[model samples]
Target chain A: MPEMYFSDAIRAALDEALTRDASVVLMGEDIGPYGGAFGITRGLHEKYGPERIIETPISENGFVGVAVGAAMTGLRPVVEIMFMDFILLAADQIINHAAKLHYIYDGQVKVPLVIRAPAGAGRGYGASHSQNLENVFLSVAGLKIVCPATPADAKGLLAAAIRDPNPVLFIEPKALYGARGEVPEGDYTVPLGVARLAREGKDLSIITYGACVPLALAAAGELSEGGLEADVLDLRTLKPMDLTALEATVAKTGRCIVLEEGPLTGGIGAEVSARIGERCFRALKAGVQRVAAQDTPIPSATPLEHAVLPSVAALLAAADRLFE
Target chain B: MPEERLLSAYRKMLLIRLMEERIGALFTEGAIAGTCHLCIGQEAVAVGVAEALELGDEVVSCHRGHGHLLAMGGEPARLLGELMGRQIGYCRGRGGSQHLSAPGIGLLGTNGITGGGIPIATGAALSAHLLRTGAAIVCFFGDGATNQGVFHESLNMAALWSLPVLYVCENNRYAMSEPVCRTVAGGDILARPRAYGISAECVDGMDVEAVEAAARRALAPLRAGKGPAFIEAATYRFCGHSKSDKLLYRTREEEAKWRERDPLTLTRLKLEKAGWKETLPWIEEEVRRQIAEAEEACRRSPLTPPETALQGVYADA
Candidate 1:
């Protein structure tokens, strides 16, 4: 295994998918010689050429709908929206056509496609460019939402999403793109609806995913110095959440804190906390506390950006409530 | 085109007219629910274009799509079952009239949204081009759809890549009662695609021969992978936009003027002029019997079960 940046892992997965299947093609803006906005697909274009790695016009709705149509007509198209915010323009196709085709067409057709977007708000990219917008797609029934927090999971989940016969939204947190982790080179995958237990403890569980995974791990590390241990579970797949892993960790610790980097209202943290309250109420020893960003648009200035998003300090403070 | 081929096209146009007439009656009698968009006077556009299509050529239609569905060989029973929301429907009752599809004959679907199927048709053409499947796609949308940003986006992409697509714009004069004059820029629908570098033309949508000739000419360059072509079929809808529309937007005088040029009456008159005058009565009787049979089969079709709604939201994953 080699230590690879989160972006390299994504490129590796796309490279592998294109090589393994001829039906697989990449359609997006600036994914060719421009090396993509974040350079995740930097060199795959050179290797695959223009046809397989299509360079589409600056029409998000056009290309996204084309990908959906291509998916229906026996091609697996992986689309890249430069920024997550721009994905709003193509939401009608993603929600109306690609998501509903399977049911509406009575399973006669399957939209086997993946949409890769760079999301989240740690960078000072301002409100529209840096918001976490996957929450809007969470409730869409047929869509599978995969948010990878590590290089290994990013590669594995992306590859799985491409091969899976459904529309999958593979969101790479911008903060995690440059983060390095041990990743196996070829033919690797992490199944949807499964969680990675990052660390184990008996006192409490820190449930988080995507960008918040690192912060939760660091918070768990700090708590150990004072002899207060915690269990951290990274929920890589949001829509089909890992109920078994969530229950086991919460039942063992009897105390839990849900952490998310997005706004607290209607966020993934809200969904997870509600599920815990309903399913694990009898096993809990303390009320479940949620650590999340304030309900406001992320400011571009560094200090204000830091104030609006979740932090390890916030996770530690939420952890302190487990003892009280 | 031979007289027999003309007669066959005439029969299909006749079938679509009678089928819709029966469908309209069904709606009035409360046998079908939800919205119904009847393309009664626009049969020439559907049959003419369908006649020009070869095997494996798919079609994407709009809300006013019963004609297109029938023209592309969607079984009358399945389409009727679909309109009635029964299990025997094209989508197993999952898709009502507007969303029904027959993949067997390459009628991909009739879309629920205006201009929604343009990109999908473009994508299918892209797939055919890449895979060398030798398939072309025909997308039938209203003139009202030209205002959609996606219609322009899809046309731009198709022209840029030379994808094999035929964008057939049935300018039925209105988009749900807002006539093209009020909505489109200068009401110049053909200029949109022509600006995108696609070859566009206007055809007499009321004349089956003219519409079919235009479709055949359009398909020639498309099958050769010559990007996309656009055809603005100047036609009108005999019925209101939907079952609920009151026809207050236009006058009976205007309706009667268009009705005089009805596709069915014009095609039948052409056949009559060609010494096949006696065949018209016999052809109409057959069409009536065919629709009656379809309605009988629809009555026999089972209702959609409540439990089926939960199935197939996602493929086996």
Candidate 2:
């Protein structure tokens, strides 16, 4: 019943999880006392105490493995990697241990851990701080990848991820942290692997997630005036994608456009488009069009960054191609 | 130590030696898959440290972990089944010898990577402290693992948090073919942990009584929640590092010298001197029976079906 920004929604969800489950704890650099580099965990340390809200040193690998170990031993730990690029330091634990423990142990061990990382290019964080690596983890089998587009979805999906009995990579778009939305109070959850249809139209279906979701929505609105009604679907969970919804929408619309902020080559959009093409080959009127970033490191300047990443105009143009 | 405790320690060491020898034979016969690092000659470290632990206390072991698993009262048949890649094993054939686990026996897990288990052990100690379980964690690693960065980071965290963990370094003088002198800048591994402000001790790893006594003293602060402690057991590996490794690095004279201080033989002699009449024969027969049962289980255990490959990728989520 209250308006909440994406960051506030994360905080609310973490607070709710901490209150509901005593086993849940948060640990990361600058998460406690300083609230978090982005202030998402502000006031949590004071309320939950140091035991639950721990401030770890800058040992990403150590803390990440510690989180995995804790999760295996009945504790649910939410580890925050300060930047998405820094996750490479902890890749051994994330890829080798957390993602493979369940399979290697034959269901005997569960790495019920949630790793939150801020991704995407924006705010002049430069090349190092800005990179969309959802596809890097999407290829991994045991991990569940979720990128929420709205405050309400962030709160609901994060809550569900913490409670779910698997390792989840929850990537929060840094640019959307302050974006506000109407989020309900009290306990609420949206199941993973569900795609939300943000805007419904018959002309074209624009499937996207994370930062691209907002851009896609904006593009859908602009397309309405141009007499092309485009449907926008926000794929909140990327790993176990909502193939059912995608196929049904593409079948109905007969045209599709996949949008992603990462490089067009080997992006998640490729996999989504391929799957849709394979499933709805007979129903689709045109091949799936992709609106993605250019294949290069995110540039520092604003104009270059805009040129590289997918813009609302880019999505509108792609939708226009799909309709035409 | 008491006479009965001494005899029990001897029995445990004998069991580990026999079990590892059998495992080595299985590896030679091509019955075991993956890399198998046996703890054949380093039985005292496992038996001594395990004897010092309570029933609910936990231990995280290194790749050379058969002795550690057996010393903690693991079922020999199931362990052998695990090494043979059978579904009846502790990890259901998923984790072979290097990644074996028996959480029920307080053996948290054994890892293959050097120094990988240190942080997990630290986390387990932290969990015990938070849950008020009063259970101390015993982390066992080879001298090679001391070179890993996680070892230092975990020690610092454990000392800072005063978590209940006993860092046991089985300094076997060689990490694979490289001698400890070649790899370690500082000659002493115990001193490295001591620099982290944790209480440290160096003990004769070949002597079971000495290791047990040193472990008891080192674990006092950990049990009292004062902080963590470190023990560097100065031992030698009479065998090569793994099944494929040849003993080309060391001469036969050196191997014979360490074998002279063999933990099983020393414990047997100690038990005999303490008036235990048939200790050696009884332990030998018990170990023989265990080896036979383990071998039979290994032969009879079913291999993991290929269809269940994707199972447990996530815990029913």
Candidate 3:
């Protein structure tokens, strides 16, 4: 089989979803004929027609609510927010309505919707476009947050999300879209809330997701040369985190380092550290260290942006601190 | 309308009015916390539209939603228990009158935000269309909600999709002291929806029969899977916007004029003229019984524990 780019994997998953279920539809700004901004939904409009590949107005709140309503009624709508930054416009429907509807209704109603958006810095999109908001959604309950770094995981996780009974926020790393890797051709699904071991090690555990996963893997490879083998865990799903896998890795390594593209304060790393402290308190060797972006907006300058965000070097430094 | 159905309409309106009155008394006595937007004079709109709907059909209401709940055959005791912040309430007392839902009776939910339920109803209608179910959704909003951007967006989508939805605009003339004339730049609310390609009409909301007739005609397309419909019912609310509201905007004479066109009285007159003499007393007794049961339920219900306050924030657990 031919190797597929991460973006093509997403398109394949969407195509499969549309082909399998008539109720599954796609809606977003400039998504129909123009394809997606990153060309993830190319040729879907012509194949599915207007009803399934809907091109909506720029009103995020309006369309998001419509998707919520559509999802609640029976349609599994995969809505795309042009960028992760624009999701702030539809916060009410996403947070208050979609997130709480099921629990508020005592599980009587289900909002089986998927919101896909591109997240993380490295594109030089500046402060507005370059953001990792998985932490923000990690705070919200009733929502499943998935950040897939590889092409195969992207396709598998998206398929699982569309089939899942609850609402899922699927954040694809924009930096990794053009990157290519091997992916299966037939139908497949990757279970949510489960972390994947990118590489095996026993000296230290490195937990990360999205764009940081590849960087963490690179850091692990480099650390291995320095006689320190780091166990790299890719947290595919942020909420309902695979704490079991995390605890097992932490128990073996006795040290952990969290790598994130978002800010250090109130980041997902904070939540992970808190939970790990509560669960594996005695097993932890020094406190868990977080290697994340500086507490500042992402700058437009390439050098300044690189200085703020965590790179492979920063992850290596954090791991060294965990051992010391 | 049949003699029995006419009496049922009158009784439902009376029950809502009397229940609102009881809620008002309890609110003033400090038994109920938070704001209560009572649908005192707008009983006709709720009862009228509800009469034409099937048991499986859904309803999404606005802030002033007591009448909407009661009209959909919601238990007054459970609703009152919610208002009184008791665990036995519809939302486990987490949501007050403004956020109540009886999904079993097809009352999808009520929203506190003006024009919020519009999209929800549109979604519900879209769901019905997708599932091929004949269950149309009746979305109730005040005349004030007509100016909202969401209202227009939802109506346009419903029209474009031809979903099974009925947008019922309960035009009581005021959106919390802002008159319809000042709020609405357009002439008629019915025309606004009609511009969206939906078949719409204005009805005498004060007359139950007129409201039901309009609903029956509008619901035809939805039942046939043709598309959605809109109805603008010109009604009135006797009370202020909320419990803490002071009557500074409208005059006493204006309130009295609308009071004369009371929906309950109009329906009762129609029932009596049809030779149903025992209708009034029976409705009064039923209203009294419901109020007593609601009050008793409120008194006996338990309060939600503080620790469980954050329990339902997510569906994972």
DockQ of each: 0.83, 0.60, 0.49
Q: Which window of ten consecutive residues has the lowest lDDT sum in model 3 chain A?
A: A100-109
lDDT (Cα) of model 2: 0.87
Model 3: colliding residue pairs: none
| lDDT string, candidate 3, A100-144, tens digits | 777766555788899998988887999999888777788787888
* Predicted candidate 1 versus true structure: per-residue lDDT over B6-109, tens digit per residue: 99999999999889988999999999998789998899999999999999988888778889999987788889999898878898788897888888988888
TM-score for each prediction? Answer: 0.98, 0.96, 0.91
Please, what are the lDDT tens digits per residue for candidate 2 over residues B199-297?
A: 898999999989999999988878998999999998888778988887888899988988998887787777888788666787689879878977787
TM-score of 3: 0.91
Cα deviation at A204, candidate 2, in Å, is 2.2
Top candidate when judged by TM-score against the true structure: 1
**Candidate 3 wrongly placed segments (more than 4 Å):** B29-31, B84-88, B185-191, B222-226, B272-278, B294-317
Structure candidate 1, residue pairs in collision: B162-B227
RMSD of each: 1.1, 1.9, 2.9
Best by DockQ: 1
Whole-model lDDT values for every prediction: 0.91, 0.87, 0.87
For residues A161-261, write the lDDT of model 2, one tens digit per residue: 99989999999999899899999899999899999998899988999999888898888888889898888899999978899989988988989999998
